[model samples]
Target: MATGRAKGRGRGRARGRDETQDERADRMWSELIQEVRVAQTGVQILFGFLLTVVFTARYPQLSQTDRTIYIVTVVLGASATGALIGPVSFHRLVSGRRIKPQAVTWASRLTLAGLLLLLATMTSALLLILRVATHGDYTPWVVVGVVAWYLLCWFVLPLWVRLRHTTID
Candidate 1:
């Protein structure tokens, strides 16, 4: 009495989601867009704030090193914002092309790239801030520690879950 049909019963599907390839793509695209929206809001806000730093009175008082760090951080933030927003443009251009699956793949890649850029921007911003907040020698150590934490949370845990618990199709 073995019904080999994995249809409708949600069997033999990866992670028990039980969906067709197109269905999976659609679900994933929706999920990816939602995630992008959250990240986009954060990065856009951070980038906007970064853009305003040059107008602050304290900007001219910053050391040359700090200025360089600020510039790099701004560039990273802008890049992250672009990458995070790239998916929308990609989706718009490909909407009627009958390539939802391909579009989803590309969008996911862009989101990952955006996340990486955001990490770099955050690390640079932290370094600059800590350097200004405390002139002590421990500033670098604090930045490194914070970067490690971000890495753990942003990259390591998700990768571990994907590798450890995911089933291959």
Candidate 2:
């Protein structure tokens, strides 16, 4: 079995896990969809809450800068929501065209972009809330710390794992 694996690797193997190209694409598509589902649910909930904030009685008391931040946060949330849901629409449109490999690539890109947008939205939301809650200069530092944590969990750690563990081939 080890020798057979070595021979397969030496021949520029097509797919890992013994899957054919189409099967690989299907598996990848499924995994990407699952990831999107988790992200989409969160963003959608956040966006829904954001949309309702403007009508809240407390919204009128926010400072001009806070209002600006709120607007930016809402926009970022909307963008993130769109990006996170884009993969589903992309897949649906391209389903019968037999171009899943390309679709998967596009979906993956969209998912990454969505996650970045989500990070921005969450950071902005946190900053606005902290500013309103604390009414102090320390809010920025606190927000920075939280954002760093998010970056570590969402990006840095994943990248480290990818680089540290993945085969160079």
Candidate 3:
């Protein structure tokens, strides 16, 4: 009798789990959707709040530089929202095409792009807020530290675990 890892076409691959291409794709798609949902909610709320900032009475009093930062931050937030939501539209349009594996790959790429955009949006927003509130030289330094923290939390630790815990299947 064959072992569990040898029972599927994915044997000898990455994690060496027993799953066919379709099964793997299905599982990945489900996981991706859950991740996207969380990101989408955050981006949507941030973008909505960003949209309201311009209407506030204090907006017109902001310096030219502050206004520019605000504009850039809003644009980044909008772009993040679009990319994060792209997978849903992509899946809906391509469903029943029997190309789920390919669809999942594209969706994952979109999700990654969305995450990077979200990171940019968040950092930009933070910078703008800090500059407005502090108007001090330390604001940029503080923003840099926060960005590093985000990178560590979002990418570095996960990558470290993936590198350290997994075997070379």
Candidate 1, 80-158: lDDT as tens digits: 9999999999999999887899999999999999999999999999898888888889998998899999999999999
User: How far in Å is the alpha carbon of 93 misplaced in model 3?
Assistant: 0.6
lDDT of 2 by residue, 1-169 (tens): 5653355565564324766789889999999999999999999999999999899999999999999999999999999999999999999899999899999999999999999999999999999999999998999999999999999999999999999877754
| Residue 164, candidate 1: C-alpha displacement in angstroms | 1.8
C-alpha lDDT of all candidate models, in order: 0.92, 0.93, 0.93
How many residue pairs clash in model 3?
0
Point out where model 2 deviates above 4 Å.
1-15
Give per-model TM-scores: 0.89, 0.91, 0.91
For candidate 2, the C-alpha RMSD (Å) to the true structure equals 3.5
Each model's RMSD to truth, in Å?
A: 2.6, 3.5, 3.3
Better-scoring candidate (TM-score), 2 or 3 = 3
lDDT of 3 at 146: 96
Tens digits of per-residue lDDT, candidate 3, 1-169, equal 8666656555444446568999999999999999999999999999999999999999999999999999999999999999999999999999999999999999999999999999999999999999989889999899999999999999999999999887764
